[model samples]
Target: MTHALVDSQSLPAELRPYLDGLVRRTLAVCGRHLVSVFAVGSIALQDYRHGRSDVDVTVVADPLIPARALRELAESLAHPALPCPAAGLELVVYGADFVGRPCGAAGYLMDLNTGPMLPNRVSFDPADSADFWYVIDRSIAHQAGRLLYGTAVRQVLAASSERDLYAAMQASVREHAGGEGHLGDNRVLNGCRTVAFCRTGRWLAKREAAQMIATSEQEFRPLIETALHSFQHPRSEALPLPSNDVRTFLAWVGERVDEAATHAGIGDPGSGTYPDG
Candidate 1:
């Protein structure tokens, strides 16, 4: 099995053992088919909190990997089999073919969610309904993902267009406002990040984004500070987040994203896939 050089010194000390085990287990299951394994989200952005954030991973496999191998991989990586050190493990596997192509949408071979307080899900559908999150994730992965075991991320993953990112941000805001996907401090932080992304096309950590927004938009400083505190102290008995205020903030963020999109001449955010270029 070919392996890529990873600068272990750069990663968090707490994550090393778990990541080592993950790579070994994945190699055992996928063998020669494994192309790359990289981490995105907070871990890549250098904002990982042991008890608060999940280890978001994207694994690429050769296009012809068999169904049985996929199943085995899921079972092998599930919590307890290879215990997660963090809150959970959110891992997605995609065929190399899919990553190499320029088409839109999240095409995956398997999506595994396992660890404490997380649902034990193993989905194999390539056309999963939650396309927005995956699309944004791929963009983040391309821009800032930390390689664990594989070829360089940029060389493998196709770059998502600004249009698709704006569409995804819009979908994410809608979900948060409707109380569908993320909740509590996560909802607030997500909104902060979305607003930051709209202004500058860079993805910043939740804390950094919230702090940045709080500086200019002094009116929302209290809300942003509360979310930051809550995120850092996950186990603390914090008061319930102000739901109405959060919703209002998310709606405002949606407006900002729309204005940014219009200014960029990206047109209205739509649900369908657009060209990757």
Candidate 2:
């Protein structure tokens, strides 16, 4: 079993130590045919917080690593125990063929090389970039970009920007929402698209106007409400969230937006300066 560590430059300085140790431990446990390991998600992009996120590490190996082996690998990473809170460490496992398809924003995954029973290298397209503008505009986008893994995770981020990732997310969303109910699928799709476009517009506004938004509410309620209306569902199902659940999700996202802006140190939208007219 050979292991290739992701370059260090891709991870946030704060996450590197934990991630490196975790990778080493994972290798020690899964010494069975562990071909290579790479870094994915936020930390790979160099933008994670010490307390706000989980590290994303991608482990690629021979086919069928078994769920049991994967679980053991997770336990091993914490063998000596990680310094951060126990709740924060998470391990996500995928097949050498896990790079299935690009459904939504997660982008499509394609095989980079051929191998015996499984492929070793794969590519992902995630939404990012100033042109794309969704990367840092949305709170989720901003948070997702902060991930770190392996000994040298930075190399992956060096080749990728938010723009290259735009498709990966789209792919993931589509896959999640797919199935029999056309209306149900479309409803979820609308919500996802609205968020995606809103992030894009927000990015544009910040770039061109030097302000976060125009006609601002404390959050995105107004925009979400407006976009929700664009879907042609009967008024009964029109609110997006079920009547029982709408308020809760909205309130949750509302708080998140406010909190995210504060953390980034973006003061309230600057008041337009004008002489009395």
Give the Å error, residue 138, model 2: 18
Scanning candidate 2 in windows of ten residues, the lowest lDDT window is 268-277
Off by over 4 Å in 1: 1-5, 235-239, 271-277
Per-candidate RMSD vs. true structure? 4.4, 15.1
lDDT of 1 by residue, 1-277 (tens): 3323376667788888888789888988999999999999998899999887899999999989999999999999999889898889999999998988654577899999999858889999966557788888898898899999878998899988878788888888777777654657888888899899888889999999999999988877898899888887753344467888887777777788888888989977754322111
The TM-scores of all predictions, comma-separated, are 0.93, 0.41
Candidate 2 TM-score versus the reference? 0.41
- What is the per-residue lDDT of model 2 for residues 66-179, given as tens digits with 9 covering 90 to 100? 656655564455423445431144333434333332112222121121112122232323322111222222223233323333323232222223333333233323332332
Evaluate all candidate structures by whole-model CA lDDT and list the values in order.
0.84, 0.37
Candidate 2 off by > 4 Å = 1-4, 66-68, 85-87, 100-194, 197-277
Which residue pairs show collisions in model 1?
A: none
Worst lDDT window (10 residues) for model 1? 268-277
